[model samples]
Target: MVTYTGDVTPGGAPDVRDAGGLRITKVAVDEKMSNNCYLLRCRTSGAQVLVDAAAEPDTLLPLIGEAGLTTVVTTHQHWDHHRALKAVVDATGAEVAAGFPDADAITEQTGVEVTRPVRQGDVVRVGEVSLEVITIAGHTPGSIALLYDDPEGHPHLFTGDSLFPGGVGNTFGDEAAFIQLIDEVETKVFQRLPDETWFYPGHGGDSTLGAERPHLAEWRARGW
Candidate 1:
C-alpha cells in the first residue's frame, strides 16, 4: 500500500486509501473554502457513504457514480461542511444523517431532512462496514466523529470539525465550549483508543492519536 498522505487540493485528484475492509477517498472541493468530502466505499458490497458533502456537486456526483451513495453524513451544522448536501442527496436519493442535536439546524439550512438523527452510540452502516457515531459537541451542538474499528487492522476515525490534526477544532472564543469539546474528546477518544488509531479531519491532512497525544495539555492550556 502506498502512503496515504491525506493531502488534497481543490480540483485535484482525490487521495484514496484502503482501510482493511473499506476504501476511503478524500476529495478537496469548493475552491477557496477547500473543504474535504470523504467517500467511504465498502470493498465487498460496493456500498458507499459520504462524509460532509461540503461543495461542488459536480465533483462529488462523479465520485458517487452509478452505484450511488447510501448515506450522506454531515459532520456538524456548519455551512462550510455541508454546502453540497442538498444537491448530493437530491441527486443520489441518499439518506441524510447527522448528530441528533444538530439535525434540525441541518434540515433548516439545507432543506434536507436528517432521516437518521444519530447520537453518540448510533451505528451507521456503509455496506459491510459499520461506523460508530461519537458525538463530540461544543464546536457545534451536533458535531460528531465516526469510528470504524477496522477489525482487520487498526482503528480509523472520521472527526469532523471537532477534532483536527493540530488540536481540537475552533470553538469561536468560547472557553467553556472549548473545555467541553476537549474533555469529550479526551475522555471518549484519547483515553479510549490506542495510539495507532488514525483520524481524518474535515479539512487538511490527517494525523494519528500518538502524534497528537502529547499536546493535549498544550491545547487545553492554550484554549482556542
Candidate 2:
C-alpha cells in the first residue's frame, strides 16, 4: 500500500491514496500556478471522474490511461482551473459539470459545454462512488465543494479554491465575500463534518478539518 502524502509538486508524481473502494490520485499542474488536479476512480465498476483539468493534457491524459474518463468536473469559473478542460474532454468525451451559477462562465472560458450544471445536494457518481455537491460560495459565486463520506472510514472533501490549510480562499478584498465564503465553509463544511474529514484544495496540499478548525476565528479576523 502506497502512502498518501498529498504533497504533490508540478511535474513530479501524483500522490495516490487507496482507500478501499476508491483510489484518489492527486497531481500538480499549471506550472507556476501550481494548481492541483485529482482523479477519483472506483475499483468495483471502474468508473472514473476527473476533478479540475487545470492544465497540461500531456500530464493528465496519461494519468487517466485506457480506462477513459467518465466525467470532468470544473470546480468554478476560474480560468487557471479549467485550462486543460477542453483537451481532456475532447480526448475522453467525458461529461462536463460545474456549479450552476458558474457553468456559463466556465463554458465561455473553456468553450466546453457544462452538461451537468450542478448545485448543492446534487450527487456526482464515479461508478458506484458518490460525491455530494456542497456550494461554498464567495471565492466565486458558483464555487462548490464535493464531499465523499467513506462508508468504512472518514469523509473526504474536494474544495476547489475554497477552504485550505490555513485560511479560506481569497475573496479579492471583499470582506462581505470573505465572510460569505467563510460562513458557508463553516456552516456547510466545518460545522457539519467531523474533525477528521480530509480536504483536497484546488492548489497546494491537503489538510484535515481537525488541523484547520482551530484557526477559524483567526481566519475570520484576518479576513482573507
Count clashing residue pairs per candidate: 0, 0
> Each candidate: RMSD to true structure?
0.8, 0.7
Worst 10 residues of 2 by lDDT: 13-22
- Flag regions of model 2 displaced more than 4 Å: none
Model 2, 1-224: lDDT tens digits are 66788999998989999776889999999669999999999989989999999999999999999999999999999999999999999999999989999999999998899999999999999999999999989999999999999998999999999999999999999989999999999999999999999999999989999999999999988888
- What tens-digit string does per-residue lDDT give for candidate 1 at 50-139? 999999999999999998999999999998988899899999999999999999999999889999999989999999899999999899
Q: How far does residue 19 in candidate 2 sit from its true spot (Å)?
A: 1.8
CA lDDT of each candidate? 0.93, 0.94
Scored against the true structure, residue 5 in model 2 reaches a CA lDDT of: 83
TM-score, model 1 to reference: 0.98
Error of 1 at 135 (Å): 0.6
